[model samples]
Target chain A: MAGYAVELRAVWKRFLGPAGETVAAVKELSLQIADGEFFALLGPSGCGKTTTLRMVAGFELPSDGEVLIQGKPMGKTPPYQRPVNTVFQNYALFPHMTIGENVAFGLQMQKVGRQEVQRRVGDALEMVRLSGLERRRPKQLSGGQQQRVALARALVNRPQVLLLDEPLGALDLKLRKEMQLELKKLQREVGITFVFVTHDQEEALTMSDRIAVMDAGVALQVGSATQIYEQPNCRFVADFIGETNFLEGSVQQLQGGQALVELPGGLSVWASMAQPVAVGNPVTVAVRPEKLTLRPLEAPLANQLQGQVVDQVYIGTDTYYSVRLASGQTIRVREQNNLAALRQGAQPGDTVCVQFVAETASVLTG
Target chain B: MSQPRQSPWLAALSGLVYFFLYAPIVVLIVFSFNVSRTNVVFEGVVNQGPCGPFYWYCELLQNRSVADAARNTLIIAVTSTAVSTLIGTLAALALQRYEFFGKKSAETALYFPMVTPEIVMGIGILVLFSALFGWVNSMLPPGLRLTLGLGTVIVSHIAFSIPFVTLVVRARLHGFDSRLEEAAMDLGAPPLTTFLRITLPLIAPGVLAGAMLAFTLSLDDFIITFFTTGPGATTLPIYVYGLLRRVVTPEVNALSTLWILVVLTVVGLSQWFQQRE
Candidate 1:
């Protein structure tokens, strides 16, 4: 816990194609993670998340920078010399060996004493809840079971860093969710630095302590889940993280730190921050569907607009309404269902007023 | 639409094709016991001119020279097949695993010997050994002649069998998952240990199949061995050729039947092992 578990400094990797053409897989990326932290690289496909993980695992070497483990630079260090292990996407379990043998493979390679290897392998399997499956080959297990065996194999080595490259991508939804919690528990018990890579936003949000969301080989933001969801820095993260309602308008007037936005047809709305926009600068206002509150047509409130409900959908625990404003812009509003109280329902042609607080919305520049 | 009754035309055509392939072997086996020496005859049923217990067959078996030749042939076939499979499988793994310059050229070179004419290869080897060492006849025993002996025959069989083994092993390697080896390496195993413990076991069935093929090919080989063997190193095929020319004896037919039996046994075992995997 005293030293950084892993450090990657200005790493750049380029792959040469068959015809002498170079394709940059990763640009200069520098990052550090303390001991026992669960850091995740979240991004879409071809965004260099997997490439970055491979470089740390020593499967691929960076063309321009140095990688370090425990305060020592890794120059041409083979995978066996590095104190790190990787769980590949497809599990990569040895089909010819039994589960116990696969787990003991690393210990046997180090020529550890026989009894010690067996005890550690058993403990690793038990941690993953795969006890008593020692003699079964990988082909006999289900996809999820195979993935657990792979995890056990990598963990048996007691490496300083565990690199997971989309380990749960091959599993179905239910199994993936179950393993997500299991992995979190295992990480806590082992207390090692875990660097995981995935393209699923929800998965990252649920398990990671810190996330680095990347796009096209560049990391756009790194923060806690709440920060990433509530205050995305750009249009990509805002659209990728969750659902948002966007309103295009220009800043009609700015005072102090707040600005009044004028929508088309002279409808004015107050925005909380004018840091990203000046007077007469165009911007898009983003508000969550749950943030907008609906009321009767006669209610009077600041930032109030009258609109007709065009459609309504009743989910199990909530009701959603599509409201059309006077200028023909449709806005979505969600209301929680209260089973104990009875109220009048909004119809397709009913006029309604919707209001959003000034602090509940933010403006997007691009 | 209702399916038509079994097509008589299709059945007849396929039956004719089967007959076209097997008719010669059937004719040869049937005439092996013929009594008349006119080289062709229908002996019909019993009392066929006092057949004398097919004495030509017993005489052939009693000859010590024939027994020695059969022993030599079996030794060469088994040994060469084993060695060639080892080399071929290693070559196949190298070709399939790594990316390097001249890979395509290396693959083509491995297959080149398989397609070359046997006579040309035999003559080339004979010339090279004689010109390089000058020991073809001047310094060798009679049984160790370059054109006829156990050593030359084994060498020739191994040369031709390697390409077939490589081709079969390469096909199996194509479907293999190399990540299994990577996993082993990550687990702290060295490169060679990973290959032996994980990769080889997964592809053992393919190696067995390739060895069977090499054995069968070596057992039946004639042209190459005829050019490279010594007098004492003559194999079953060369011996049968001599009998077929000198006397046109029924003993040759009996020998041919034995060869067919050995070939079929190897083929059956190969198929069984392949299906088991």
Candidate 2:
């Protein structure tokens, strides 16, 4: 690897609140995006994901700290001076100009030659699968087509890094899914680093090679999708990424990197320590619904517990069971609706043994 | 698509209101063709005059003072519209985009001219100009002394027209998506280039509407023009007012008809341009 395509060194962005107090939108967050990597800043609203994206785009400067693009320290460089492009959420296509002009805008702004602009604009449009609609204005295009035009407009510049601020937020669910795959494919084809900000966890998981999950102006965790979902470092990251069953427990013993935690009702389960924990300290064991197997064991087993199925929902591919443990803690289990599983499907009031994929389950301290 | 059902009485009332508004102007236009110099009675179209059916229009063209007034009106209207539109658009942009000291006060003050009586503002401008001229004239030589003329009238017209232009342009700027500007900047256009390539084109309709409004106001202004105008700087309105003091001739009617036709054509052209965009 040559260097990071983009880096934020302890960036902080503070804004004046409506009541005249300083509000830190982004608080001392640092990240390094790899070259040609598809990275996502995933968070709920008010979590400073958009602010971080804007800071990278140079539209909003950091109140403190540094943003480096391609190993160059960009200290107070205006957005125009930055070698980056942005795809705004609304697509922000120029309504007054034709699609040809909109796509050619960045090239013309850089004072590219007339013939070069025309050829590159045509190529960029074709790259986004919008070759024949150059003469049409923005209003004349459909929503998905406008989104493609927006992509072409940015991709035409061929910047080192492309910043997208919730680019697919406005699309319908079906279109969003299609565009998500198309964008990933296009990013791979172009081989430019992408740093996209979004609130949708599935979109991040489905597209990004690495994801930084943020909450309340702080990046809680940053890792790959499997690492983030299978091994969350914190309770917030675990809950934010996907539905996780948390059982309150105290550490009984530590072995290798795993922990033996004793739950209420004298039940014990073995869980992986994503973050180190002290023996006799209270922690929460997080296990995903799909990771838990609901089967009746011969007797009792390590990483196994007893529960009665209080609710079961058949959702075509999988059956979701809400099982209540003897300690009265509710845990949801998702099992595939195979023929054998369906034949022995447990309904409400049926006692079943819930097995944990202990190697993948996380014990979070906070 | 289903439209709301219209009431016949409401339609009749609206028609009556339109007639009430346009009847006098229509009468003024029709009377312009009268052959009689006294426009009190509707004389038949002049088939015997040198210009055939356009007798009064010919007379209106022959009036040298009226020609001077028309020329002065055009100069003042065109100059003030151009300058006011430029300055007012900048003012609107600053108000909409930037935050500075006294911004709240400035926002409130922008609508003062729109709300204040034109006659009151005219007198205030007249007094202010007189005071300024009085101060400067005392220091300058008599041969090169400044006086109230087209300059003062244009200045006053620009002052009053700014609030209107700013209001219209500011309203347009409110709907503008600032992300377009950022997108341009990210594409390597500096702030100025982004404004020129993106911001200006989008808000152009609002700027044109404001300019048109300023132009019409300058063309038809009487009170403000009256207070600031001097000898040889009389506008068409002032000239028409002067003529009404002694005689009510068909020349005035012909001038009014021509003015109405030009304003209509300009408005129609602007509407067409907006639709074309």
Off by over 4 Å in 1: A17-20, A249-283, A296-308, A323-331, A339-345, A349-354, B1-4, B8-62, B112-152, B248-251
DockQ of each: 0.69, 0.84
Q: lDDT at A267 for candidate 2?
A: 84
**List of clashing residue pairs for candidate 1:** B147-B228, B147-B229, B148-B228, B148-B229, B148-B230, B149-B230
Worst 10 residues of 1 chain A by lDDT: A336-345
> TM-score: which candidate is best?
2
Q: On residues A21-65, what C-alpha lDDT tens digit does candidate 1 reach at each position?
A: 997877777778778888899998998999998878777888989
For model 2, name the residue pairs that clash: none
CAPRI accuracy category, model 2:
high
Alpha carbon lDDT at A320, candidate 2: 98
A1-366: candidate 2 lDDT, tens digit per residue: 546999999999999999999999999999999999999999999999999999998888999999999989999999988989999999988888999999998999889999999999999988998999999999998899999999999999998999998999999999999999999999999999999999999999999999999998899999999999988999999999899999999999999999999999988889999897999999999999999889964599888989899999999999999999889889999999999999999989989999976796899995
The DockQ score of candidate 2 comes to 0.84
Task: List TM-scores of chain B, every candidate.
Answer: 0.85, 0.93
Candidate 2: regions farther than 4 A off? B1-16, B270-277
Interface RMSD of each: 1.0, 0.8
